[model samples]
Every structure is written in structure tokens, then in C-alpha cells.
Target: MKEDAFCEEGDIVLADASEDVDDIGKAIEIVDIGGQRLVSGLHTILASRIDHRIVVGFGAYLYASSGVRKQIQQRAQGAKVLGISKTQLAEVELAYPTEAREQQKIAHCLSSLDEVIGLESHKLDALKNLKKGLMQQLFPQDVA
Candidate 1:
């Protein structure tokens, strides 16, 4: 495999194609490689920062931003499976602060918010399950 094909820390792997239209162009940034050789699979776009302008961890969230997502969804094609070519992917412009510090701050804030959201979601699921159990015990089903 070519060296460029391998994913490294800070690289963003984007889903260029997916059966679900909402999933088109979704991306994930590789924060750590863990000493493993990682490569994006078929139907993915491997993106790496050519310069230090865009800080690490920014690309993943940038693609998820409203404007970028709208652009991606608009450009997505096909009936059964949506897809975007390299050129199409490139056409989705991103707006970011020119300052590296600003970019870092934004990425950090978003990451922290994501962590909180995950914790809250788990708690919500647990509460829902508890409520379900309570309801079942309170009102038993009549056996036929």
C-alpha cells in the first residue's frame, strides 16, 4: 500500500458513499493511531491537512457543521446509494478562524461538549429503561 493511503494522527476519513443519504460525507478525525497502520476502506475519502492552518480535530466537526452538511446533502446523488466524488467533496467549502489558537479552542470546546452529550445520552437511556420496568411492574399484563 502507498504511504499516503495510510491514515495517521489528525487525518480525516470521510464517507463519500453510503446507502443512507444522511450519512454521505460524514467524517471522523484520527486523533491517535495507537502504533497501528490504518487505512480508509472503500467508499471513504482520506483527507490530510496539507498545511498547519486547520488544527487537528477540526475537520471532523467542520464537516458536521450545518453549512457543510447542507452542502453535502445538496450535492449527494443517486437513489439507492448516495455518493460524492473527490471534486464534489472539494467543492464543499469550510469557514474557519485564521488563527491556529482559535481553531484549537473551537475543537477543544466541541470535543468537550460531545463528551458531555454522550454521558447525558447514556443517563437518559438508563432513566427510560427504569421507567419501562416500573411501568411493567405497576401494571402487569393480563394472561389469556
Candidate 2:
């Protein structure tokens, strides 16, 4: 079975203890539907702000201030997973800004970044194709 087969939507995931732990602490939101025992490749990072209690999904980063962590720990008592209940998921406190306009601005900035990254990727692909064509012309090879 694929590694993802074990995960379900809304389930808090802990990185496999055996894998590299660098990006293991972050939680991810599943965006695709898979079988009861199937794994999927689509996921987004779950992030929240401490002072402002704002929960958001990020592309590759998740953040929670120390205060948020403490709150989650306090509430995690008796929280059971597969068969264990431990303070594994970090807690985050989020606060919504009173001004809707400001919130929109923040979201816009992040969206802009995503767009820029996508455009840059396309440009890189075009450049690679151009180089391949040039190389083929510069050094034509014949097969016998």
C-alpha cells in the first residue's frame, strides 16, 4: 500500500518517526480524496498565529507562536490517537483582524506570491526547452 493510504481527511498526522524530522512537525490538510487505504500526494500546510488566532493553510510553511503551543498542550489531555493520547499536535491561537480590508490584503499578498512562483517555474521550463533545441542543432548525432 502507498504511504498515504493510511491518512484520512481532518486527521492530524505525525510524520513517520523513522523519516527525517526537519519538516515533520508541521500539520497538513488533505486536498484530495483517496480510498480508505490509499495515499494521495496533495497536501497543504496548516498554520496559525499565536497573538491573532488566525488559522490559515500555507504552501510549505506552518507557524505557531509559543503561546499557541501552550494552549494546545493544555487542551490535549486525554486526546487519543490510534491508541495513544499525547500532546503531539501543537496549539495555535488565532485572532481575526477587525478590518476585513486588511485581512483581504494579507491573503492577496500570499496569493500573489503563489502566482509569481508559478510564472517563474513556467519560465524555467521554457528556458530548458530552448537550451535543448540549441544543443540538438549544435551537435547533431547520427545513429547507425
Candidate 3:
């Protein structure tokens, strides 16, 4: 009953082989034949598509856009999705400045913020461990 198995690079996966289509949607990189499994970034359709749209299936709608998030949430509400119908998902609506440079700047700023948060988290963990070690040395324990 081991869950969360990892796939190695360059692995070829077969379609409809998974017990759950939702798991296949999230774990596998691509699907073919209108719903067959394929390696991520190696498939023809995905590679050719230029839109920034992300595909989501049933039980796997958690990874979908925030717009449709509410609808999916209403259906399952914390339960993993099993499969999502094509009609259930819709195109995402994003509002951004017309200038390409401004868009790039915004994206860069957000990315930098994420990196800073990650580094701060690591530093905080290290500091907490150091404080625990110091407390252990400062406190005396009675031995019987």
C-alpha cells in the first residue's frame, strides 16, 4: 500500500493503465489519443500548444485555476478529484498590463519574493535547531 511512487526521467507510461485517472492527470506529464497517457514535455500536442493553459482531470482539479476552483471545491470539498469533464473546466482570465516589460517585471518580482521566502524558512529552521541545542546544554539533568 505504498502511495506516491516517483517516476524517473525518460520513463514511458501507458494510457488508461492507472487505477485513477486523476492520479494519472497529476502524476503523468502528458495524455494522448484524446485521453491516453504520455511522457511529459515529450508529446506532440502539448509541445505544439502555445497557450498557458493547464489541463486538469477529475480528482485532480485541485491543480486547476482559481476561477474554477470554487466549483470544484463545492463538488468534493477537500476530497481528491477522480476526473474532470471537459465542460467543467474553463479558460483562465488574467488581467495584466499591455507592456511586455511590465509583465516581465511583475513576474520577476513575484519569483524573487518566493526565493526570499524559501531562504528565510531555511534560516528559521536552522536557528530553531541551534536554540534547541543551546537549551539542552544550559539545562542540567539529574542522573539516578
TM per model?
Answer: 0.91, 0.45, 0.44
How large is the C-alpha RMSD of every model relative to the true structure?
1.6, 9.4, 10.6
Candidate 2 error regions (>4 Å): 1-18, 27-86, 91-103
Candidate 3 at 80: error in angstroms?
6.6
Which pairs clash in model 3? 57-84, 58-81, 58-82, 58-83, 58-84, 59-81, 59-82, 59-83
lDDT of 1 at 1: 82
Assess the local accuracy of residue 31 in candidate 3 as a C-alpha lDDT between 0 and 100: 23
Predicted model with the maximum lDDT: 1
The number of the candidate with the highest TM-score is 1
lDDT of 3 at 40: 35
Query: Candidate 1 at residue 6, lDDT?
Result: 96
Candidate 1 off by > 4 Å: 142-144
Model 1 Cα lDDT, one tens digit per residue, 27-110 = 888887899999989989998886766788887888789899889888989899899988888888888888888889999999
C-alpha lDDT score of every prediction, in listed order: 0.87, 0.44, 0.37
